[model samples]
Target: MTAAVRDIWRHPIKAHGRERLAQVDLTVGAALPWDRVWAVAHEAARFDDAAPAWAHCRNFTRAAGSPSLMAIEAEVDEASGRIRLTHPDRPEISIDPADPADAARFIAWAGPITNPDRPQPARLVRAPDQAMTDTDFPSISLINLATHAAVAAEVGQELSPLRWRGNLLLEGLAPWAEMDWPGKRLQIGSAELEVVEPIVRCMATTANPVTGERDADTLGALKRGWGHQICGVYAVVTQAGTIRAGDPIEVRP
Candidate 1:
């Protein structure tokens, strides 16, 4: 099926906020630039910044664990190496994540929004080379709008693509077609990406992006409708190039 780029998003801080983008440069064998570059480790987390590496999602303060985090929005100032964060209930704040004092400020601001019953946020951790993506390897998530519509239909509610927290959004593909694309190659704009695997659904999908409340049974809908808890596909860039919204996308066998 023919498809085209619909939207692009980057989360400079994992599970904290999202930033919309019009265009981005994809490098071969790398995750999206500045995406999930920093993550807030919880008080109980064993994440060591002196020797940073990928840990389970539980180590970080996530929307799945704290629904309020879903409502936050973030913008990154590349020149200053700072992120400006905003939430409906809180004042806008900018913090330079690399600075210890600024990181402490972020922790203070995020403490209340975090689930009190669970581990509290303590500090921010940065990845050594690539961003701290969920997958062990560098990858970008692609969500098909048609598939999202299908899920929304099954759940009987209007769902937002932001709920999936994907990097690239595509349109004009059949529902569930992406589930069978693990070995396929997609040519998007000037870049080529190889489908790596299907992205498994998590509780984070149930949270409303605007309200930061659990309003949908997205995992249940995916299981009942598709017999699996999967929505999007993860792909790794094989050819470095620029990608933009409205760029044509073609899948190759």
Candidate 2:
């Protein structure tokens, strides 16, 4: 098996924005350091707090769902236990995950995505152990940029690589062609994460990462030719360690 570690990212807050990293420390069965560690939940969130379970959907609200959030890019300052959300057009934002005052600021940052009709305020919650991200995986994501390009060729649109929101983006395969990689084990960085699920393409893809415009039929290009509207695979960590961009990947039987 042969593979290469491409890109690494950690989203301190889901759907808000992602922070790229030179390297990340991964623990077996744990998400990369702090990737998708928390997310905002509306007071109207329809789930049982007594028995909370992770939602099995890549449900992110960005400019498509909330335009204001598009301007905020989160950065993790580990030394301060703070995540700073910066924007080109807005005032600099700094929040401490452990402080309630910062939580209020987060609520203010979210307007369109907030459901005011509900009694509880929207708060950022951490991704819990055993929580799967749209599938059964603690922490691992991969996408083949080649696949994105192939899809773009067919659709005649230039899609940015950031649109996929993947932690591992590769550069040498056809569009939506990672389907062939399922059931294989990938050696990324110093860890081995098994490719275990087929990423289900959804409406999120239609939402532009930059302009926040809605582009329908993002999946149309895939269904027309690709066996699946998937450009990547989800992985489960079989081993734990640090991985960085440019690390070689290997497929193991």
lDDT of each: 0.91, 0.66
78-172: candidate 1 lDDT, tens digit per residue: 89999999998888999999999999999999988888998999999977887888888888999999999999999998999999999999998
Candidate 2: residue 200 lDDT (0-100): 67
What TM-score does model 1 achieve against the real structure? Answer: 0.97
Per-residue lDDT of model 2, residues 113-151, tens digit only: 332343433665554464425554575778887777777
lDDT of candidate 2 vs native? 0.66
Alpha carbon deviation, residue 113, candidate 1 (Å)? 1.0
Return the lDDT, model 1, position 120. 93
Q: How many backbone clashes does candidate 2 have?
A: 9
Clashes of each: 0, 9
Cα deviation at 13, candidate 2, in Å, is 1.0
Per-prediction TM-score, please? 0.97, 0.84
- Candidate 2: stretches off by over 4 Å: 1-3, 48-53, 58-72, 87-89, 112-121, 127-132, 174-177
In model 1, the runs with Cα more than 4 Å from the true position are none
